[model samples]
Target: MPHTLIRIDDLEDPRIAAYRDIRERDLVGRKGRFVAEGKVVLNVLFSTARFAAESVLLRENRVPGMTHIIDRIPPEVPVYVASGDLMDAIAGFPMHRGVLAIGLRSEEEPAEALLARLPSEALVVALAGISDHDNMGAIFRNAAAFGADAVIMDRTCCDPLYRKAIRVSVGAALKVPFARGGSADAVADTLEAQGFQVLALSPSGKQAIEDVERAPRCALLLGAEGPGLPEALLSRLPSVRIPMRADFDSLNVATAAAIALHRLWRPPTL
Candidate 1:
């Protein structure tokens, strides 16, 4: 079946509301939906079963190159096309990428439910107070790359589904399975209850990450950039640090997560 393409000459058209004022709208909130930008992110949205697309909006010139992706989308989903100037006006910015999508994630499940479903041997990432979207996205990308089973985010963490995060992750945000909510200790308690060796990543950690032994299931807990993990939380869990220069205390949260995940990651054997 051929995909329907609608030309957008009217800025007031309700169907393309998802694409309007994209910069502000992305931060404002999408209720349950998220906007996916660029060809790479759009391809992940179309290919992944984790989310469903409400519609696709793109510059007219992008349509011809996107036929392969268009055919894969359900016939009922509308594809809106607009001229470059119109797209820029609608998006409230210079729309260089020329592609956008509206997608909805299913209702979020509790962290406990996500922990309960983990396999016997798995790698999980638990985040606390990570309010930066770019860091959150980079961590998710690292999680996916290192074969983590799931990601658990605490209440204070920023949304991984945020547009910049999604774009920065290069769509890995959509690919990874994650659950967010609950207090920092509550999240840690849940992981501990699930038999995960909850290891907090901290600069003051007594153990070096390279020397720490891998457990059947492990959760790497990380906090925000400046403060690192809170002392209250750090005291409760076994902590591990990436060995660094005497003068350097820490790496960025995302870079640290990538390094730790690589050390703890257990890739499945076929």
Candidate 2:
């Protein structure tokens, strides 16, 4: 079904209010809503059943190129178009990409519930204290690239649904299944309870990543750079380190995750 396009000429229109001053509102909570920007992210927003499009705001000229994506929007969702000047004013920025949408996230699912749904053979990413949006996004992108079944984040981690994070992930954040909430230890506990062999990544880990054996159900535990995983948590789990140059002992959390995920990921047999 085709999406109805609404024309807006005025800046004060209440219908586009959620899109106003997007840069300022990016940090402030959007309740259950989030801004999905760029053509690529919009594609995932429309393609995924994990999220629903509440509405879309596009530059009038960009509409000609967006029919394929627009067609994916449900008939009830509105697609609004405006002039470049009006879009710039509404977003408080250049609005160069000329694409944006309000995506609604459903109720948060429990970590236990999300883990329970994974297959008997699964690879999952568990994150702790990952406060940087860029790293969070890159990690999700890597997870999608490496075929990890899901991503589980602890309470201290930043929101993957953040506009910058989602944009950085190139929509992988929307495509990959994830669950948030709980302490780092609590997250580890849940993964273990679901039959996952929790492997913590840190510079001082007892074993090198290449030497570790793969488990049928595995969760790669990663933490923020510099501080890395909690020392206590590291002590409790099977820790693995990515070997580097003689003096260098660390890798960025996201890069480390990619290496570990690649090392552990086995291509599914036909």
With candidate 2 superimposed using the best TM-score fit, by how many Å does residue 148's alpha carbon deviate from the native? 1.1
Candidate 1 Cα outliers beyond 4 Å, as residue runs = none
Q: Over the stretch 1-270, how does candidate 2's per-residue lDDT look in tens digits?
A: 567899999999999999999988987888889999999999988898889888999999999999999988898899999999999999999999999999998888898999998999999999999999999999999999999999999999999999999999999999999998589999999999999999999888889999999799999999899888999999999999898987877677889999999999998889
User: Number of the top candidate by TM-score?
Assistant: 2
- Cα RMSDs, all models: 1.3, 1.2
The superposed Cα distance between candidate 2 and the true structure at residue 160, in angstroms, equals 0.8
lDDT of 1 at 68: 86
What range of 10 consecutive residues in model 2 has the weakest lDDT sum?
Answer: 245-254
TM-score of each: 0.96, 0.97
What lDDT is reached at residue 236 by model 2?
96
lDDT, residue 153, candidate 1: 90
Error of 1 at 97 (Å): 0.3
Candidate 1 per-residue lDDT over residues 1-270, each given as its tens digit: 688798899988898888889899876788889988889888888888899999999899889899888888877678899999999999999999899999987889888888898889989999999998899889988988999989999999999999999998888899888998589998899999999999999988979999999799999999998988889989988999999999867688999999999999877788
